[model samples]
Target: MKKVLLVFCLIAISTLGYSQISGGIKGGVNFANVDADGDPDGKTGYHVGAFLTVGAAGIFIQPELLYSFKGAEDFDLTYIEVPILLKKNFAKVLNVHLGPQFGFLTKAEADFGGGSQDIKDELKGMDLSAVVGAGLNLPGGLSAGLRYVLGLSDIADNDALPETKNRTFQIYVGYKLFGN
Candidate 1:
């Protein structure tokens, strides 16, 4: 019984230490929207980030640091967002990811009667979001993926304008630092 227990511990330790680490840069564009109360319109934005991957077999975890721009076009509202997700590969060239995101209202620009001007505080300051996506590995160590960012927290404080939330779709291109 003692010998069996020792062998079991050794196997477990070996498996835990056999993971590989990889790092790379990723960037993408977002089709964003600020859902107020009624119709939802699309806006243009983008994100840039760095990622670290640790994995064994077909499963992996990827942690990313990103700077993202999000907004609505008709209303002309924008925010800076950061998202982190854990990813798992189910096939040799396919994977899925889901995680949480937080955003800060940075600069807001709008068109007044005379001309466009920068506005100070039109909405809430911070927002919380949920992210989910799928990825495909391409040729030459490159990968492409698409993600959806859905606002889970309200960003509006005014009752007249209605509570608003953010929704976005992002397409990403990335390079694998290390993985099989």
Candidate 2:
């Protein structure tokens, strides 16, 4: 995890030296679910973040910092997530995005009819995921997109529990802050 973060940072820093930079804030709705034994029900949550894009000529590297709420029914988890994406633009109105997302678990809770209990210690501290999406870049800096996040790492830390992974579908809107 540390090595991955270091590499991402180095790439971002190097790209900044020569690439054209643009960025914006975004927020969205998340449909989150867990892939595990018994098949938990999906939960609706939210995410808000900022993104920075560096590159030119229709290709770009975009790095995003986001606070995301994700979990299944009766369970809630909060994560600070960083996604480094390769974005390709087409026709000035359409784009495709693919990326690796790194998530750090910040909070976890489970409800068992009686009340909510903190279950943070039972989960892994870091999560790795892949993201794929498409977007429409509208006129005047506005944009809308959809993304699917597929977890690549097991989140359950307990040996006795079934392996658990996260899956999320996101719908979001954004407006470019500057640059081109």
Candidate 3:
């Protein structure tokens, strides 16, 4: 995990030296769920984040840092996630992106009727996911997009438990803070 993060950082830093840099802040709604032994009900959550784009000529490298709320049914999980994406633009108005996302768990809880219980210890600290999405770059540095996050690593900390992974669909709006 450390190595993967290190590589991503190195790539991002290297691109900054030659690319046309742009950045922004974004926030959105999340429809989250867990794919496990039994199909769990989806839950509503949210995410807020900042992003940096490094590149030009219709292709870019975009890296984002986000705080995401996710889970399913009675379970609630919070994560600080970093996604490094390859983005392609069309006609200066439409774009598509795909990437690998690394997530660090911050909190976990399960609500049963009257109260909630901490379940942080039962889950892994890190998660790996694949993200794919499309967006529209509007006038005045505004943008809107939709994405699907598919978990690739099992989140269960115990061998006795069935494999569990997070799944999320996100709808977001963003405004560029600086650069082109």
Q: What is the lDDT of residue 34 in candidate 3?
A: 97
lDDT of 2 by residue, 78-129 (tens): 9999999999999999999999999999999999999999999999999999
lDDT of 3 by residue, 87-127 (tens): 99999999999999999999999998879999899999999
Q: In candidate 2, which residue ranges exceed 4 Å CA deviation? A: 1-18
Q: How many clashes in each candidate?
A: 0, 0, 0
Whichever of 1 and 2 has more TM-score, that candidate is 2
Clashes of 2: 0
Candidate 1 vs 3: which has more TM-score: 3
Worst 10 residues of 2 by lDDT: 12-21
lDDT of candidate 2?
0.95
Worst 10 residues of 3 by lDDT: 12-21
RMSD of each: 4.7, 5.5, 5.5
